[model samples]
Target: MGFLQRLGSAFSAIIAFLVGVITLVSLLLGGNPGLFGDLPQAADLAALLALPAAVLLRLVALVIALGVLIGIANLLLTHAQRLMRGRALSAALLGSFALTLFWYVARAGDTSLLEAVQLPIESSLAALLCLTLVGGAARVIAKRADIWSLLFVLSLLIVLLASLPWAELEPLRAWRDWLLRVPVSAGTRALLLGIALATVVAGVRIALGQDRAYRG
Candidate 1:
């Protein structure tokens, strides 16, 4: 760590430690003393966690929800195009399929009533950037009998089908629950453990001014 960086980090650590101690003390003393007062109850709160949208507001609500989908496609297409330029067709196709699939899973988090949406003006523009790339990649990989991407895309298609309107995807929904309850549940616990360990290490390193990330 550089001298100035160490100095700044030390200052931040001292301030943060003091603030945290003060917060705990305030809570124990039976009074809210922070800048913010009471937090909203979970039952009273809107379904949006990642969205700052107030569902009571008609237009703002629509914009924030739709904006999540639009922003995801825009960010993903940029990287997919770069992969396409490198003629990494497998990577490109897999990237597109994965990006769409993950975003679908996340945005659909607990909302079961609505069909997944794709805006023509936005989706067409986004798909145009990568679908052709995926096609070209598909052809090239076919010659080598490479079916990794082909398989992934097909699996993603099945997942999409499971989410579609006409499909009695109740079975898929059950499978989704199982996926979370079985592997995903365990994996998340493991990931949290990993994150906790990393946090402790990072905290120690920062306190000792050995973290390069904090130096900046």
Candidate 2:
């Protein structure tokens, strides 16, 4: 049994490696004939290379849709069980879900209900988030009292004040714009690059059969 399992794992790893490589190459070199130089039928070769990635992407989208449906069904089932146990929160959740679903179907895809209900909820959450950030910054400054902490608090204060409509905040608004345009943009890009690198590393591990989840 152990030997059979090892063999199955090896087969799966080989298949995964080949598929990953094909998809990566197709996506990288598929659309640009210039990458292939002046070779004969370069465009045709590029098209052929692109086909596999396109088909695989469509399959991935279909799988994602199916997964979403499965998730919704599971949520409903779990919440329904809780509702049977007299959980008011679960009952509210299920009620809201049913109402939203019914509204969507009944209105022939009208989303006015969502705009009226969801938008205010989202705005309120955003306001709460701003307050949470301010509170956290204060706590950090109180506990640490370091240069970085002070800078963080000052930056937060400036940004918050800049958001006000008062004429006294006009100068701070320029500073806020510069902070957002330069440092914030750079930090955001750095985070995105890091995430991309991490994703690539994970993909490489999976492709190389080093990921433990694929051992089965």
- List lDDT for all candidates, in order: 0.59, 0.88
Instruction: List the lowest-lDDT window of 10 residues for candidate 2.
Output: 207-216
Best candidate (score: lDDT): 2
lDDT per residue for candidate 1 within 1-71, as digits (tens), equals 79997798788777655544443333333222232346554323322321222222456568899999898
Candidate with maximal TM-score: 2
The TM-score that candidate 2 achieves is: 0.84
Write model 2 residue lDDT over 106-153, tens digit each, in one string: 989999988999999999999999889778877997899999888888
Q: In candidate 1, which residue ranges exceed 4 Å CA deviation? A: 1-158, 212-216
